[model samples]
Target: MDTPDTPHVNKERIDTMEHLSAAIGVSRPTLSRYFQDPDNVSRTSRERIRKGLERVEYVPNFFATRMNRKSTGMIGVIIPYLNDLFFSRLLEAIERAAMDVGYTVITQCSHSDPAIEARAAETLMSMNVEGALVAPLGNHSDLDVHERLRSRLPFVMVDSRPDTMPEVDFVGTNHYHSTGLATEYLARVGGPPVFLAMPRVNFNAMERERAYIAKMEQLGLEPRIVGVEGVSGAGYFEAHGQAVLEREFSSGRLVASSILCVNDRVAIGALRAAATHGLEAGAMQRGGLRIAGHDDYPLCPYTVPSLTTVAQNVDAIGRTAVARLVESIRAEKSSGKQILKLFDGEMKIRESA
Candidate 1:
């Protein structure tokens, strides 16, 4: 179905850019410019091109188009885990924000492997991406690859950061504020909560743990920490939470009636452990253990007693990361000074605490 506003007379043989441009009634240069960035062309011509492109069957050579332009109109985002809903939500928000400003996102999932993480960074660099956003693998990440990307492109870190890169741009939740909020809130309602720590997978684990310890000390309380600390070993997700809690229960070493888990995943596992131990999750008044977690996860509210944790400003995190990265990308040269944007994490009180 051809429209009257456009010059799309051909039903066949529109396989070349030149022919497509002719069919669309635009100059070759304008067509090329439009292909590079639709916003670069005037609205009228852009609409005409859009309408005509649908009629034609010409597929622009993606690599050829990128080779001709200095601006790729593309941003690369490398995430540590694609299966994790939190990262998935963050990625979704990043994509929407990038699209709002007329940019395409190229995503790579690292699968939580150091070699894979390094390779992902290298792949984006090889593609000549205008910029990159990474949710690093913390201690396990290859910093050299990120360093190389930082040298040539506008690079930003999301969620977590490795220790070596002190001057890189980062956008994430305020771990101190988040963990402290949960710790203090739990102490006030119940007794001082024993910290249930996650494996040292990334800087976030330590950040949250230290924040909890600091808050507990500030309250003049003993900070009892449980769970494995060596590395992100065997157990995944809830399994880690469940196993640690079960071990503490068996050992009869877990003190403090209330428990604060590292995150909602661990918290959920702890809840399961409580149920397994014939303990209920609710207020301490019902002879139940008060359990709280960090990062008011998507499933937190749906948990048996609903998890009481801190709410990270995921919207702000995602939007701010893209804005900061885009700003850096547009700069003639990136401002070398490290930029850190930490969004606040508010306490979300629920039945679990």
Candidate 2:
């Protein structure tokens, strides 16, 4: 008897779909159609293919098969930065959603650079991808690159959309409502918090700042905006945040009694700065500053005193973006009607206000 580990025994088994079809007395084309979609084959042929698969343990090479077709069966996912936990988590969710439908995800990070973003678009276009989901670089993006690509393929914009691409499909959180939610909560429990703005790198930040100003005005309070200057790139939020806070403290301008950061990263930076100055942060800490942020990032719960934040439905965003793109790809035409899907944010009140 041949043992399972015997080399010759393994070599005798069918390894490819062509060999398996020959062994099962079925045509190779029939087997290929079944592999593409089992429902496409007749019941008798499907049963035969299933039996053959059980005997040989053959797994089809998806890439090799896709190369022969016009559609690559690949979806491109583009983001500004992968090191940021927000984008990384969003990418993972998008990948999961795409794989569930038998499509592969090709991810590219722009590193917050417009030139690199344009290059990434060109690469995806050259790949002949079935569709693409892009989280654009906001104001810094090249509109011509996106316009040319969208003219030829189906693309869904995730998170941020360029103003020039108003006709494109979009999936994102409602920044205005979410920011208002956070601002209102902070004002209700603590003194009206000052808005700690990050450098205006993206539309999301600008929306948050606008929302903060609007909410403060509605409450009949003066809106104080302290922005971090001369900072860009990943991991700069905390450092610039700390520097901005230090300046505010020394200048006696940190008078709001609380600080609402543009995002969780900036809030974390402010927390670090407050700690360095021997000032405690959180609602329960007396004589300390109340701090809050947006996005409810992965690390928010583990912060020194935890964090209060507005949590965007990232999973929903990813799933919706993929679904929309897939629909467009199936339609094979860019619909003149543009669709916008926005998910709401939930406020989580923690120890930090």
Candidate 3:
């Protein structure tokens, strides 16, 4: 049943309905109607369409055939850093899930910059992305950009939280509870000495800080919360971060065996600082100081004597974010208020505490 004008003979390219209508002498519209929800059409016509479909290869242009007139078969996924394993793993999962459903995924990195994040969102919107899955830089993100996109494109926040963008769905860890676990682990193993935090501007980090303070108070320990001063991006291997860690290391009052970090990178920097002062970061029984981190990075296990940390389900976060965004796009409505989808983060006890 080869049509002279058929573009390709692949199983997916066949115009089964058209070919069957031509062969069985049925109108194209009636044949089309029969193909879409066969129960709605006459039993005889449905049977004929089914037989025709089986005889010839064909796949509907789901982008065109979907009941929703607006879905574009494309989704935009944005993450804070593409190089970070947590974000990268999440993106890979999202990309895989999107491809499985025949949806194209366009990924971008905000580089933890607000302007860049805004530009990236605008770019995706201009391309007419059906939906977006963003792991924003939290406070660094431009709320206006998100607001505009929320008005038109379906979007979800993954792995990060803004102040309160009610228009978008949020999928991430419950930092407050997760950080409490981190604190409790520290109290049980090393005792809480200092909790390293970044700017209070980040909603998630703020939650973690509050959890740390609350846990410290509960355990009747003096909470020494240290904020890494300077720019927001400085938390990531910036010179200011080194200086901050240096000061922490130099402060002789920090008697706590383990220091809780905002994230893996911050812990890494602090660990390096401790090492510079000839302090070993490992189990006390093994004759070394203890350090603990959050968001177990890929290199955590490789850090000298290994780094103990909290591990979030990065892959699950990405998969769920994409699935949720796709559903919102298909639903053609964002009225479903921002859902705080929190996945439990587990503590990986290792050499460091």
Rank list by lDDT? 1, 2, 3
Winner on lDDT (1 vs 3): 1
Instruction: Estimate every model's Cα lDDT from 0 to 1.
Output: 0.84, 0.84, 0.74
Instruction: Give the better candidate number (2 or 3) by lDDT.
Output: 2
User: On residues 1-353, what C-alpha lDDT tens digit does candidate 2 reach at each position?
Assistant: 66678644342465687787788889988887887778979999999988877667577887666766766789998899877899988998899999987789998888888999999999988887888899988787888888877887788999987777777899999988999999889889888789999778678888789889999999899998887464443346777777778777766666337889999988888888787777778878877478899998999999988989999999999999999989898885556788899999999989888
Q: Per-prediction TM-score, please?
A: 0.88, 0.86, 0.76
The best-first sequence of candidates by TM-score reads 1, 2, 3
| Deviating ranges (above 4 Å) for candidate 1 | 1-15, 18-30, 37-54, 59-63, 230-234, 253-256
Which pairs clash in the backbone of model 1? Answer: none
Clashes of each: 0, 0, 0
Local accuracy of candidate 1 as per-residue lDDT tens digits, 67-181: 6897878899999887788887899899999999978899998898989988888888888889999998778788888888888788899998777786789999989888988
The segments of candidate 3 whose C-alpha lies over 4 angstroms from its true place after superposition are 1-70, 231-241, 285-288, 332-337
User: 1 or 3, which is superior by TM-score?
Assistant: 1
Error of 2 at 202 (Å): 1.4
Please give the TM-score that candidate 2 achieves against the real structure. 0.86
- Given candidate 1, what's the lDDT at residue 312? 86
Model 3 clash count equals 0
Error of 1 at 79 (Å): 0.7
